[model samples]
Target: MFAVAAAAGQTVRNAAQRQLTQTLGTVGATHVRFLFGFPFAVVFLALVVAWTGTPPPRPPAGFWPWVASGALTQIVATALMLAAMGERSFLVVIAYTKTEPVQVALFGLVVLGDAVTLPMAAAILVATAGVVLMSLRPGQTASRPGETAGGGARPMLLGLGSAALFALSAVGYRGAIISLPTDFVTAASTTLCVALAIQSVLLSGWLALRDPPVLIAVLRAWRPSLLAGFMGALASQLWFLAFALTAAANVRTVALVEVLFAQGVSRFAFGQRSTARELLGIALIVAGVVLLLWVH
Candidate 1:
């Protein structure tokens, strides 16, 4: 349930951030998620603390590294994703990012020592292939086998890089959350608060020093940016809760449903229709998701 909510919220957040990107650029738009979201994160943490009647746990020596990695990598990943949006169709960009589940499986194994069963691995592969198929354009392979359909290698590379970084971020956040010796809600909320603080500070400082006007623009567009921030924070909180309960691979694999949500948005909101290949890809993704749930 948390995963479902997170996926839905993330779909909305992505749309809001994408719109902001046109005016603020990638870095500024990325900053909006962290900077504007920090207050909401704080409120969430406070609510958890108030309800539980316990303070946030003090991090051990190892916690900072994991949380820091999560924070930093997520910022970069979001920037890369927003940058990719500028170069490709929204659906194509999202399809490329759906590769995160496969990458997350590998990263989770290496970083958090999470085990992947054969069925889970197969599901990841199937879903990844589906996303790759969706990324291709009609007659793309026949005309230019080496290059991507609409754009060249750059957009593809950007999307793949974003996927990889997001995978790492997920593993890192899960590692951080599980390391805490507290209840899941408290631990997840605390980790979220700290991660958002780190991201907000780092991005805010960078923007202040490098691109002041973008910061101003973010302030000017505060209404939509605030909504985007709230949605982003809500999604992150739910994601952390899901991570606390399950493997990052499982969480991310299920989160592929976000692609379907993105497709819906593309079609109805943007009047972009899915091709036959894309529809086939969506079917494969659904099959993979169903198999994954059944196996689990």
Candidate 2:
């Protein structure tokens, strides 16, 4: 349930960010999620504390590095995501990032000692194959001027790189939450808030120093950024809750439903059409998700 809610919220957030990317550019758009979302994260944390009667998080020596790992990697992954959204068809772009489940399983096994059974691995592969097929559009060419000679490959590179980094971030976040000596509610809320705070500070400082104008632009574009930020925080909170409950691999594999959500928005909102192959890809992803749940 947490993963489903997060997927829905994230689909909305991604659409909002895709719009922001055109106006703010990639860096500014990425910063908007952290900067504007931090306040909401704080609010969520306050609510959690009030409801749960838990004190603010007091970490020992290790929590900072773990949370920081999640925070920093998320920023980079988001930038790559926005870059991919700039492509001609966002449906395919989204399909590419849906590859994260396989990578997340690997990261979780290594970092969090989460074991993957043979059946789980098979489910991951089935789902991953669907996205890979969608990402490999026939006769795809460089849609932008700055693309390399292997222009067709740029989206795949961006998407796969983004997937791998997002997988690592998932592992890092889950590890941070698990290491905390607190209930799942407090741990998830506190981690979400602190990670956003770290991300906001670092990104804000860098933009102020190197891209003041873009920072100003981001500030000026507050209305849309607010919407995006709220959805981003909502999604992160739900995702953290899910992470607090299960392995990152399970959370991410189910989150593949975002591709189906993306399909609806792509056709209706973005005026982008998915090829027949892409629809086949979405079907395969759904099959894999069902198999995973059944196996679990």
Q: Model 1: per-residue lDDT, tens digit, 163-260?
A: 99999999999999999989999999999999999988898888889888988898888888998999999999999999999999999988877878
Task: Show how many residue pairs clash in every candidate, following the order shown.
Answer: 0, 0
Off by over 4 Å in 2: 79-96, 141-159, 270-274
Query: Per-residue lDDT for 114-219 in model 2, tens only?
Result: 9999988888888788767765656655557875432446766787788889999999999889888999989999999999999989998999999899999999
For model 1, the stretches where C-alpha displacement exceeds 4 angstroms are 81-95, 140-155
**Candidate 2 RMSD computed on C-alpha atoms after optimal superposition onto the true structure:** 3.0
Clashes of 2: 0
Per-prediction TM-score? 0.89, 0.88
Q: What lDDT is reached at residue 145 by model 1?
A: 49
Best by lDDT: 1
lDDT score at residue 52, model 2, on the 0-100 scale: 88
Worst 10-residue lDDT window, candidate 2: 147-156
